[model samples]
Every structure is written in C-alpha cells, then in structure tokens.
Target: MTATLIVIGHGMVGHRLVDALRELDRDRRWRVVVLGEEREPAYDRVRLSAYLGGRSRAELSLVAPEFAADPRIDVRSGTPAVHVDRRARTVRTADGDVLRYDALVLATGSRPFVPPVPGRELGNCFVQRTLEDADALRAAVRPGRPAVVVGGGLLGLEAAQGLQLLGMQPHLVEAAPHLMPAQLDVEAAHILQHGADRLGLHLHCGTTVTAVHAGPHGAARSVTLSDGTVLDTDLVVFAAGVRPRDDLPVAPALRLGDRGGYLTDVLCRTSDAHVWAVGECAAVLGRCHGLVAPGYRMAQSVARQLTGRPSEPLDAMDTSTELKLLGVHVATFGRTPGEDGSAIEMTFREGVSRYAKVFLRRDTGALLGGILAGETGSRADLAARVGRPPATDLERVLFPDPSF
Candidate 1:
C-alpha cells in the first residue's frame, strides 16, 4: 500500500525529510505533502540574520525548482494547520478543510521568544524569524538610526550586527552577567566582549529593559532601561531565544511531549506508530536539540523506517556550540572547567590573545571539559576530541600533526 505522508512546516527539518523521501524511492508509492505556513519557499532560518545585513533572499533557499516539481511531492503554501485529529488520522487547516493522512509528521519548528514587557507591542519592534521580519527590520534601521537589541546571544548579536551595517549604533543588552551564558564561559565571554567593545558596539551586561515607550503613531520611539536611562532608537529587535511552537490544537493521536513538545521515540515515532515528530517541536531522548544537524538526522531516520531499511537510534549529543561572531570564531563545548573536574590546564600567550584550557577528572584520565580562544581555528577539532578515552595525551591530542 502507498503511504500518505503529511509533513507540517517546511523549514529545515521538514525540507530534509522531503529530500530523504525522494532518495528512498523513484517509484510513486509514497506520497509526500508539505504544508508550509509561510507564504514562500523554505529558506535557511540560520542565515535569516545575515539576510538583514546584505545576503539576498535567493541565497537562503535550500531546495529549489527541480526539487519542488518532483512528482511525488506536493507543497501547499500559506496553509496553516490549526488542529490535528489523531484518532481519525486527519489534520484541519485554517481554511476549514480536513486532510487525511496515513502517516503524519509534525516539524512545526521553533519561534523567536519575546518576553512580555511594557512597549513590546510597538509597531517597529520585531523578531527575526521570517523573511517578512527581515524586511521590516531593514526598513526600521534607516540611515543613522539608533537601535537596541535585547539578548546578547548568537542571534541577538547577529541581529545587532545587521543593524550596525545599516549605519545604526547598536547596543546589546543582556540580563546575564556575561554574553552567551549558555554557550561560553566567563573568560571566553570576556574575550568576545572585548572584541565587540573594540568594534564600538555598546554592551549592557546584567541589565534589563523595563519598558519600551513608543510615539503616538505606534512606532517604537525609545526604550527605557531598568536603570532609569532611556535610549532613543528606531529599531528594537528581540532575539532572546526560541522555543518549540505548539500553540495550535493537535489531534488526540499526536502525543505531545513533557512541557509541550511532540513526544517522539528513538526512531522519531510519536505515540501512534503511524505518526512521527521531529525538529524543534520534538523532544528526542529527553533532550531538545535546536541545531539543524540532529534534526536532519531525524528526517533520515524516518525515511529509512518507511523504506523498510535499517536506521540507528538518535543518540545523545553534546550540547556544544561554535559559530562566527563579527568575523571571530567562538566555540564552547563539554563541561565548564570548575565543575566536577580535578585539574584544569590554562594556556595563554601574553602578547597574543590565544588561549586553550582543558579539565581532567582528578583521579581518572577522562576528559571533563575544555575551551579554546584565539587559536579557535581548532574549535571543531577540539569539540570532536571529546570521546570514550581521556584524550591520548591532552597537549598531544590538542595539537596533532596536520599531516596525519
């Protein structure tokens, strides 16, 4: 029997599943229908901030024409899934139509988190999730305008830099004591802070926005800081973070995970055998991975299962991170140095800013955590260095022969 596969939200993971399905079959037994809530094609959400800076809309596309016209795939745009009826194996659309599916996959993805504070409802205020948001942000940041971005995390900084390119004096505000508290240690964050400061970007660490007051026309006029200072600005971006989107109603057949995600088993299958959930909307093996790589893996897993092939369980992944910041390479991984580690080796060249440090369990040869700055040219190599054995020899493993 031909399987009717319905995938919701054609973002990163949704698109990957479409690709995996095409690879599995040349025949037409499997029917793939993708419902994209957005009005346009699936573009890279990871690069949306770069789009605000200078990248064209076209550069963000993942699956272009040839993939779109595939015989087995039918993509429906501007269609939002309002509710899911699990027992009946049907999904209701905002247009009041119901579509039946033999197997359903929910890849609704996450949305930028905007905390409720005064003036948050202003017209010019925004979050950078869709292309429309990017367009509005670019318009708000006109020549010589001032802007403040709440949250100094990766996306927050990226959005801040975008405004900088548009001739805006960008101020980054973070409630945390250091930038990227979830990703970087205090020392590494200091290096990033210094670098950003050198770029003339004003950073307000350990502060919060008390209110955003707007002009009578409803555009953001100025942001009032918690410390009783107000910065006059035109653009106000909120890039605090993203959480799985699950506000819509779901059919009883779809089992939502603990704390609101769609629950999926090792194979990415939901409570019902015929239904599966992946991407930001899923809680896999007790952890929610936001990066694209793991979501891509889940897409591959489901395709293999449908094609009657062998696939591996989505195993535990280290919640580490590495990304470009104003052209600097910043990476963080493993445990923090002070926690559960016996000894920590810190290396720094005084004149130069290169830094490397690693922690080893006091009694054993196991690797606890490590951080690399400056010579971060080896961020990937260092992250991959954590494995079953204590690095063969910490220094030797840190710097291996390039020839090997």
Candidate 2:
C-alpha cells in the first residue's frame, strides 16, 4: 500500500523536494501531491530580473516536463493550502478541498518585507518576488523616468539594475551605511559602490525611507529619506528583505521560531513528526537561512528521510554566496571578520578596481571567512578551501599574481 505525501507550496524549494523524492522513492511507496499558490509553475526566482530583459516566462521555469508528467505526482497550480488538521492528517485548500496525507511538508517559502511607512500602499509601488511582480514592474517602466528602490541588499540591487536596464534612472536607498552589509565589509562594499556608480546607479546609503509621497493618480511620486533628502521618482520598489510565510491555520499550532518561522529539528521535521517544514518557512534549530543552497540541502535531507535513508544533520550549513550585481563581481563565504572579533583579518586592494579580505582563526591559520569584490575569479576555489588553512601563502591565495 502506497502512502500519500502532500507538499504545500511550489516554489523552488518545494519543487526541489518533489524532484528529489521522485529520484529517491524507487519503490513507488509515496504518491505526491503538490499545491502551488501561484498559477504559474515553479520558475527561477533568483534570475527573476531577467524577465525585464525580454526573457520569456517559459525560459525561467524550473519545472521539468518529465517531472510534471510523472504518473504518481499530482500538481495543483494556484491551489493554496490554508489549514492543516494534524489530528485528521489532512490539509484544507483555499478552494474548499481537503487533502489526506500520510506525511506533509510545508515549503510555503516567504513574502517580501515592505517597510511600514506612510503612503506605501500607493500605486506604482512593488516588491520583486514573483513573476507577476516582474510583469507589474515591466508594465510600469517608462523610459528616462526615475525609480526609487529601497534597500541595498542583493534583491534591492537586482531591482535597481533591472530598472536601469529598462531605461529608467534608478536610485538605490539603503538603511545600512554600506551595500550588502550582511555579506560584504565596508571596503568591499565601497568597491561594489564604485562599480555601481560607474554603471550610473545613484546610491544613498546610511539612510532609510521615512515616507513615500504620492503623486497624481495616487501613484508613488517621490520618497523622503531619513536624512531629509527628497527624491522625485515615478515608482518605488521595496526589496528590504523577506519574512517566512508560516501563518498556516493549524488546529494544534506548531512551534514557531523566535524570529517567526516554523521551528524544525535538524531533520527538517516539525514538532509533529509526520509534518515537516523546509525552505525559508522552516527555522531549523531556531535559525532561518535565506539562501537557496541551504533550502536545497534541507529539501534533500527531508527527501532522504522520507525514502527511509538516514538524513544529514544541518548543524553546519554553508552560507557561501557569489554573484555579479550591476557588473560588479562579489562573493562571501563562511564567517566574516565582523562576525567574529577574535578572527585575524587580512585585506588587499588592487588599483581601486579590486579588493579582497580573508578572516582566519586567531589560534590556527584556518580560514574563517572571506570577501571578494571587483574580481571574484577565485570564489569557488576559496569557498571550497574554507575551514582549512591556505595551501600557499595568504597573499598569493587572495591576490593571485597576474603573471600566473
């Protein structure tokens, strides 16, 4: 007799869980049911900005035709699971359908965090999270107009670049003193800022949006910064951050993390063993990782466990990241120097175009973390060598000789 596995949400991580289960469940022991809130199938949200560059919706899709056509898998797009009945082992959808499940997985993911400011509900305001959001932004884009993007993190920078690509002048506003404060140090962020300036992106760091002023037709016309500077703009985008979507109606509510996600164990299992949580919605051991890699790992671990295999513990999840933002290369891996005051820090710069920094343990020379800006050719190599001492001289490792 086959058991039923119901998965709520169909974002990248949820899709990954189903894909992994299909590969591991050789015995055909589980019938899979995936409920996606969005009408469109799973798509590559990381490159969602590419939609503004004329990339078709089909191009961003992550759903494989084979997986979609699998006989054992039932995908219900646009169907949102609203309630969970743990006692009855069932899930109730928003459309009045109740699904019975031998096991359940919550991959509801997250929602973009919009700062609570006056006039935020005005038209022409957006959050860069879904394909629909991209479509809305694309429709609102007017060539040569000004756009304000709140936040200077990865998503905010991406939004600004997309606006720029659409021929709109983009002004980035960051609450932090520097861009990507969570990942890059001040020097590295400065290097990235220089690159953004070269690309014609106006940045206003160390300030927050105090209020959004409305124009005619109730659309966002301008934003006032905390520093008393006001900039007129046609649109406003809030890319500050994300909060876990863990507001499911459960009869016996599951434990929640202090930071607001479903608290799960190392195995991605919630307080109810039959119900598991993965991706941004799951705060494994009271901490939530906002990166896709960690979510993928969690999905993989849960898939293994469901397939009767031992699951890998997520105690030391890797948080390495590398990306090109507005034509600037940036990468960070492991614990940054600021994350640990005891760590030894070393930095190097090359002619204002490149900067690199590495943090090592004070007792041992083992790598703790590193940051690279302007040049990131060594990102993969350096990330792979984390937790171990450099094989060569630290200088050569961080700043490889150009002659070589």
Candidate 3:
C-alpha cells in the first residue's frame, strides 16, 4: 500500500527530499505533504547572505515554480506544525489542521542560537537564517550605520560582508580565541583575521558581550563586553550558532540533545518507530550535522526504508569546505585541529598573494586535510578520494613517484 509521507520544515533539504521520494517511487499514488513555517518555497539558506547583499528574492529558488506546483507535492508554506499525535500518527498544524501519516519525516531544521542576554529583544537585533530574515535585515540596513556580527564563522563572516555592502561598518566579534575555531587552526585563523582587517571590518576575539544597550527608537545602539570595552553599533546581527527547531509535535520519552537537535538513529529514525527526523534537527551518531548533505541522506534513507528497499549506508564524510571571505579564500578539510589524530602536513607561500597547506596521515602518508588560501581547489577531490582507491591522476598528484 502507498503510504502517506508528511515532512515538516520545507527548506532546502526538505524540498530535496520531496523530489528524491518522487524519483524513487514514481507511482504518483503516495501522498507527499511538506509543511513549512516560511511563506516561500524551498530556497538556499547558504546564500542568505548573498540575498542580504542585494540579490533578488527570485534568485535563491532551489526548486523552480513549475516543478514546485506539480500535482504530486502538497507544499504548505507559512503554516507550521504545532502538535504531534503519536498514537494516531497525525500531525496538527498551527491552524489546527491535522494530518495522518504512515511515515512522518521531521525536517524541522535549525534556528539561530541567540544566547540569552540583555536587549536581545531590541528592534535592530536580528538573526539571519531565513529569506524573510534576510529581507528584514536588508530593510534594516542604512548608510553609515554601525553593525556588529557576533560570530566569526562562515555565516557570521558572510553576514559581516553583507552588512558592509549595506553601507554598515560591521564589527565581527567571537567568544572563541579565533575566527572559524571549529574549522581552522590558529595559523589559518590569523590569515583569515588579517583578511577581515583588510576588508574594513573590526575584529573582537576572545571576548564576550556582557550587555546590549537599546537606542531611543527601541533598536540596539551599543554592546558592552566582559572587559568593559564598548562598541557603538546601530545593529547587532547574532550568527553565533543554530539550534534545531524541534519544539512542537513530539511525544513523551523523546529526548532532545544537549546541542538541541532531536536524537535519531543511523537510518534517520527517531526514538519512535513510525516517525523519522532528518536535517539539522537530527543528531546522527552523536553529531548534529549542520550541513545539507547529511540531511539529504537522512531524507533519502527514510524514504527508501518505507518503500521496502534497502538503502546504502552513507560513507563517513570528510567534508572539505571552502569560502571566499570578503576577498580572501579560507578553507578546511578532513580532521581539523585536535580531532583525535596527529597531522603530518606541509605549508608554502611566497607572500600575501600566495598560500597553501596540506595535512597528511602521520604514518600512512594519506592526505588528511588541506587548505589553499590564495592558490588552487583540490580539497573537494581530496575529500572524495578519501577511503576510496586513489584515482590514477589524483594518486599521481598526491604521490608523483608512482613507481613506489
């Protein structure tokens, strides 16, 4: 019998799931319901900063209009699921619309983590996670306005750059000792910090914001740090971190993680048998994979399992990620600093215009991770080649002396 598939959180990963299930089972009889809180179709969250930097709303569409309107998919945007009837296998929406599903996929994704601080509720304080949020931020941006982005990670840096484009001098603040602390080492972070300095941004590392002061119009005007240093800024964009949006529609005994994602099995199944959770809200193998790939994997696995077909176990990923921060390229791949293994690596660069770093397995001579700030793009291939037979050309590149 064709089962009813209801997936909550219709963002990028969720919409991809709708497409994946259709391709996997083309019978057109299975009911596909995508419930979303946002009022628009699934769009790219990675490019939210780009949108804030003046890209039109139409540019970020992951699924085209015609495809999204296909008869097979029922996408309900702007209406969020509020309650879950575990016993009846029904999900209730905010409008009290109840849906019964044979298999429910919770793609409830994550939200920006705003640490509880004074004046967080101020008007100009914002979190850049959705297109609506981006639009709101764009509307908030004005000429010569001082802005502070309270995180130095990818999204935070992106937000800082976007704010610069909006004519704001953005101050990037991180409680960590360095920028991209989760991804880059101290050396790489220094290079990135230098790059940010060159981009007309002010940097604040190893400092915590103690309080936020509001202006007369009810917007944030300044931030006081733990060390008593104050930064005067009209806006505060908090990109510190994200937490899973798993607040609604859950039964008893279903526990949330320390980091706030819903706990799930390797196959994306939650503690409940009839339901599953995917995307940023799921903790897989004790990891809350905030990236999109794993979320898509979870979606695919659950869909296949419901169809009685065996799904392939995903290879443990060593994702090599890169981004052009302002004008400088920053990258990291495989095991980062202190990731339970020692690194054998090499570094080279002539000047500010050139740089490279390669990490290898200490004893096995295997390429573990690499960073090329001003040079080439071999990290993706390196990640793909990991744990697989080295391709001929890549092997030659990694080990030119093939005779050995």
For every candidate structure, what is the RMSD over all alpha carbons to the true structure, in angstroms?
3.0, 1.2, 3.8
Which residue runs does candidate 3 get wrong by more than 4 Å? 337-341, 387-404
User: What TM-score would you give candidate 2 relative to the actual structure?
Assistant: 0.98
lDDT of each: 0.78, 0.91, 0.78
Cα-based TM-score, every candidate: 0.90, 0.98, 0.90
lDDT of 3 by residue, 1-404 (tens): 66688988899888887887777776665778888898887888898888887787789888876667677788888989988888888889988898899888888898899989898999989999988788788888887978889888877898998999878999888999998877777667777777777888899899888889988888898999877899998889999988787787576646677767777767777788977778888876556887776777777887787667798765464345777886877776665435456866676553565455666677776766666564444567666655443354543343234254
Which segments of model 2 are wrong by more than 4 Å?
A: 337-340, 401-404
> CA lDDT of 99 in candidate 2?
89
Write model 1 residue lDDT over 91-154, tens digit each, in one string.
Answer: 8887888889988888999888898878898888999889999998887777776788999988
Superpose all Cα atoms of candidate 2 onto the true structure and report the RMSD in Å to 1 decimal: 1.2
User: What is the per-residue lDDT of model 2 for residues 1-404, given as tens digits with 9 covering 90 to 100?
Assistant: 89999999999999999999999999999999999999998988998889876899999999999998899999999999989999999999989999899999999999999999898999999999999999999999998999999999999999999999889999999999999998888999999999898999999999999999998788999999999999999999999999999998987999999998999989898999899999999999999989999999999999999999998799888888989987888998887756546988888898667898888899988988888998644887887787899657766667676677
| Poorest 10 consecutive residues by lDDT, candidate 3 | 394-403
Ranking the candidates on lDDT from highest down gives 2, 1, 3
Model 1 misplaced regions, further than 4 Å: 26-28, 333-338, 341-352, 359-364, 388-404
